[model samples]
Target: MQEERRVVFIGKIPSRMTRSELRHRFSVFGDIEECTLHFRSEGDNYGFVTYRYAEEAFAAIESGHKLRRPDEQPFDLCFGGRRQFCRRNYADLDSNREDFDPAPVKSKFDSLDFDTLLRQAQRSLRR
Candidate 1:
């Protein structure tokens, strides 16, 4: 199966989190290719994050599905986060974004399979 390596968070991010924090939080799944948070003068804010592998993207989605407090509201997470069409109409909007920069406070991910990670990283570099 060809797993999609992208995810989009629709609506406002919980606690008004910025793209920098978003990157840090999601990086635990894997190396992120890009993370973007766009602001709009009207309507809800949206974020786009792309992971290096399908598994990483899936992990991020799974993490977002966890239980949370009633008062806590997170962006609606979904697969297939392409923004090509959305970008065309965003010239007037102010966007907060980053290209895989893990912010000032680095996020430490839990241990992963080193050999598998290494192989995947190398394959990505080639492609």
Candidate 2:
């Protein structure tokens, strides 16, 4: 069996950087399977770039690739991990369920029972 290629995590990306710009930069190394950009609350951004082959991923790392932006410091690149980045599988949860009935969501206060409303009011008063 062959080793699986992992997604590469590039950190300290600029918020102004576009997805196309990122894709173009990494494409030179190999065929990128998937790419994602994550913007943080602190104003800095980060991203993940996954190559189709392990050899391509290794080439990128050995080359010490960096995202070079005009008038800004180059953003460094590194190997993320073999684990699929930020992806979740919910198929198992859905498959195990026989029924899909979900609880009704109530929006209007008038839809609630009178006794339930009174209890809520009492709880608010205690707070």
Q: Which stretches of candidate 1 lie over 4 Å from their true place?
A: 1-3, 67-71, 83-127
What's the number of clashes in each of the models? 0, 0
lDDT of 2 by residue, 62-90 (tens): 66345475676666667875344336642
lDDT of 1 by residue, 22-66 (tens): 788778778888888876756466677778787777877778545
RMSD of every candidate to native, in Å, equals 19.7, 11.5
Worst 10 residues of 1 by lDDT: 87-96
Give TM-scores for every candidate, taking all chains together and pairing residue i with residue i: 0.51, 0.56
All models: lDDT?
Answer: 0.66, 0.72
User: Highest TM-score among the candidates is held by which one?
Assistant: 2
